[model samples]
Structures are given as C-alpha cells and as structure tokens.
Target: MRSDGTLSLERRRQEREEAKLLVLRKRGSRLAFEWGLQQCVKSVNATPRLLVYLLREVCVLAGRLARGGRV
Candidate 1:
C-alpha cells in the first residue's frame, strides 16, 4: 500500500510538470503569432507610402527624359 501511494504521488508530480510545459508552449506560440501579425500589419501600412514615393520618383525621371536632360 505504501508503494502504491508513492507511485501515485510521483505520477501526480509528473502530470503537473507536463501541464506546466504545455502552458508554456502555448504561451510561446501565441507570442510568436502576435509578433508575426504585428510585423505584417506594419508592412501593410507602410506599403502605400512606399508606392507613392516610387511613383513620384518615376514621374521625376519621366519628366527629365521628356526634357532631354541627359537622364
């Protein structure tokens, strides 16, 4: 009976450790997902501004070419 009790206690301890590890893994995955989502949002927000800058540069180059300014 004493040996059985000892085994039960050890089993409970192992289960608790497994639960803790599972929680930690879940939290890590959630944090990683959030970080990736934030990076995507930042890139999406910046894209339009980058496109506008490129468009302005292209317009300038075209104007220079039209003017035959040795572009």
Candidate 2:
C-alpha cells in the first residue's frame, strides 16, 4: 500500500510473488520461485502453472514498460 491508499503495480506484484513463493517454500521444498520449476512435476498442492506464467509475464511486461519498450 502507498500513501495514496493504493498499491503501485510493481509493489502489488512483489507482494503477490512473496505470497506465491512462501507457499512453495513451506510446501514445495523451494526457497524461491523458479522459472524452470514452472513446468516441473510437483504435488497437486503446488502453485498452478498458469499463475507462474502470468506472474512471470507480468513482471517481464512491467520491466519492458519501465525501460520504455513497447509491449
């Protein structure tokens, strides 16, 4: 959350990523989210593939925008 009572997109991403990674850390035997792990075999309780892809893409798109690159 920001002073204006809303989260910046980047901030929101970080928070969400933290939540996602925490689940992995506590349950998937992972310390952090990894791109390579996205498509790996895992228990059904692990994070969904679509979430991993979307979160990664969101961050990539955000980086591109930050660098003034076209989407």
* lDDT of candidate 2 at residue 2, scale 0 to 100: 81
Alpha-carbon local distance difference test for all models: 0.50, 0.57
What are the models' TM-scores?
0.35, 0.39
Q: What is the per-residue lDDT of model 1 for residues 13-50, given as tens digits with 9 covering 90 to 100?
A: 54554454446446764443344344346655433333
The lDDT, on a scale of 0 to 1, for candidate 2 is 0.57
- Candidate 2: how large is its RMSD? 13.3
Highest lDDT: which candidate? 2
Q: In model 1, state the lDDT of residue 28.
A: 67
Off by over 4 Å in 2: 1-3, 31-71
TM-score of 1: 0.35
